[model samples]
Target chain A: MEPLLKVENIEKTYDGKKVLNGISFEMEKGNTKVIIGPSGTGKSTLLRCVNRLSEPEMGKVILDGQVVLDKTVEKEPRIDLNAIRSQVGMVFQNFNLFTHLSVLGNVTLGLTQVKGMKRKDAVERAMIEIDRVGLADKKDAYPALLSGGQQQRVSIARALAMDPKVILFDEPTSALDPELIGEVLQVMIKLAKEGMTMLCVTHEIGFARSVADEIIFLDEGKVLAHEPPEQLFSNNSSARIRTFLKKISELYGGE
Target chain B: METSSGLMIIWESWPMFLSGTITAVQLCILFLGVGVVVAVPVSLSQIYGGKSLKFSASVFEQVFRGLPALVLLFLFYFGLAELDVSPLVAATLAMGLRSAAYQSQIFRGAILSIDSGQMVAARSIGMSRIRAIKCVILPQAIRLAIPPWSNEFANMIKDTSYVFVVGIIELMRQGRYVVAGSFGNALLVYSVIALIYLFLTYCGLFLMGRLSKKLAIPGFASAGAAMERI
Candidate 1:
């Protein structure tokens, strides 16, 4: 079967300093891949590049056999960017829920606006996702009324309501409080169990161990190590990956 | 001229003052409503539109905001009278356009205060920039604009009286007429009209205050509006 999403040689530079240099990866359908790295290691940049949010100077990102951003195609042909972005939903570290909208409104906005679904149908669809994330009771509550974890779940519900082919989590739990992290991770674990294709940039070692099919260790814009969770956790992993993992577990362990 | 009778005599102009107050309110509503409709797009241009649009919007802001109300009234009333525009119409257009200038800046600042994160999230969910601004950004920004917006409402209420100079006969012009015909102490009559103006201004502000409080963001203070006075 063909890879569901392929990111090839994605090179991005910031202020003449290379942030993502020759990065490449692929996710087959139902695969969950986690990216782990030190700060400013181009992890977040990779995710943004996937959706063409931060335009990579050089790269090809193809989703579901369609070229999202291809240098060769762009010389004469360009993809419909909004259509591509809709298929690839993204969750942010800050949970970035619309402040003025209620939980139901947040989930339903993209449905009614982007997909052009009728209001009644959109609300029906939004309720399913809202229920998936266990936010049915909070549907009328505004983002300001929610805790960090609750807001993140609503954001996840929002992405799910779009019925995306793949979801990108840009350090999804990074901004979450420690106690709140488990609730979001639980929702994610449930998503993975149900075969949701996901690409997560996070330091949750426990999540990578239990859920990610593979974990790629990136350092300074290069993927230094890519291995299965079993080998990665074992001593067979790269010394760099080992050191980073050991360091994080010692600092914020059992995540 | 007796102190007790002075009160009874000024009451004779009550009908005039009442009509004047109603006209003044109508003028305020006309301009303030127009200010909102025009200012939103103008401010959006300033923030998100291309260079030419931004430049044109700024020029609009400067010309309307820089000119005094009296000059705008003069320019519109005198400028449009040649085409047979009525004084009230001319004055409403001028004040409304002027309020739009002030309001656009208010909205612009409020829009800017929102975290860029709000935008990124909107885009991530497949929303176009315009859709995101409409569905996500502006709603929050508009809420933030409320406190300052109410301040603008109060301003327009008093500014409604400025039309008197152009012969619109709102409160001030009507007050002047009543003062002219009165045999009672002129100072007492003028004072009563001043009090009526104060009453109108006060009542309008009270309603606006209630509105701002009702619609304020659930948790956050109106931080976006707070920085705008400078």
Candidate 2:
């Protein structure tokens, strides 16, 4: 079957430095694809480009057979940015929940405004998502009142509330306290078990190993290796991948 | 003897004094309401509107903020009268327009102070740009704007005295009229007028202080309280 999302030869530059240099990848439906790399490896940039938050200098991003970023296509290319964004929900590293809004408000905002649902119906749906993340009790609380772990869980619930076909997580647990990381990872593990399509950029090799169907190790804006977690972690195909895996293993754990 | 006469003057002039104060308060409230109505949208446009629109809004803000309120009132009352405009209309326009400019700056600062992440979060969740700004950004920005807006309200009340130049018989104008009619009781009249203005300003500040306390983020309040103790 064709991939759900295809990124072909995508390149991006910022002030003469190449961030994503002709990088390409594909994600199948209901699979978790983890892009693992060190800082400044352009993992976030790659995700941004795929979500069209940042325009790629060159290449095409095709989602469900729709050309998102094909420069050579038409004179006045039609891109429904909001539609693409709705289809691909993103969870930020900082858990950028609206501090001004209640947890339920944050989750139901898109449903009421974008999807044109009734306020009552939106609240009901939002409550279900909040309950899914075990934050139903805190639904009326603002983000400032929540713990970092709870805030991240609320962020996930907010994303899930949109009912997107694919979710993108950019270092979802990196900003959390070490003790809180387990809760967020557990949430991700549950989502993976339910077969949610996800492309996560993370440093949590353990979460990646436990949840990801495929691992893509990136270095210097290029995909150094792509394989199943078992082969990618144990066999170590590329020298860079081996070095990265070794360092991560030491930092996180063994196995 | 003079102190006794001053007391007698105040007692005798109580009705006129009370009427003038009431009119002045009414005028201040009216102008503030008009100003806010004009300011909120203009400020939003200035912050989120396109470059050309922002530029135009900036020009409107500068023209009103840069000019003295007295000068603006004079320009509206007298200058526009030259073109056959009514004095009351000119006074309303001048006060409302000038207050709009000042209030816009207050709102602009408040809007900018909000985290950009909020807007990003709203948009990422499928809200259109306009809807996100309306639902997410404006509510927080307006809440944060309350403190500065109270300052603006205080300024507006004080500045309503400028409408006296247009011969609109508000408090200051009434004071001038009473002093002139009372045969050179300028000191007594002006003192009463000053007291009235002070009372209005103090009330505004007091109300705003309470509002700010209520609207402040808990973290901010705790930090501020901590700093105050230190």
TM-score of each: 0.94, 0.92
Which regions of candidate 1 are displaced past 4 Å?
Answer: A74-76, B2-9, B79-85, B220-230
- What is the overall TM-score of model 1 with all chains considered together? 0.94
Candidate 2's TM-score reads: 0.92
Which pairs clash in model 2?
A: none
**Per-residue CA lDDT of candidate 2, range A50-148, in tens?**
877778888898888877788656563788878778777889999988766788888988888888899999999999989999999998887877889
lDDT of 2 by residue, B1-230 (tens): 76666667777887888888888888888888889998988898899889998999999999998998888888887787768877677888889988999999888887787777778777777677888888988877777777668878888888888887777878887787777666667888899889989998999889888888777653434422332243
DockQ of each: 0.67, 0.53
Native-referenced DockQ of model 1: 0.67
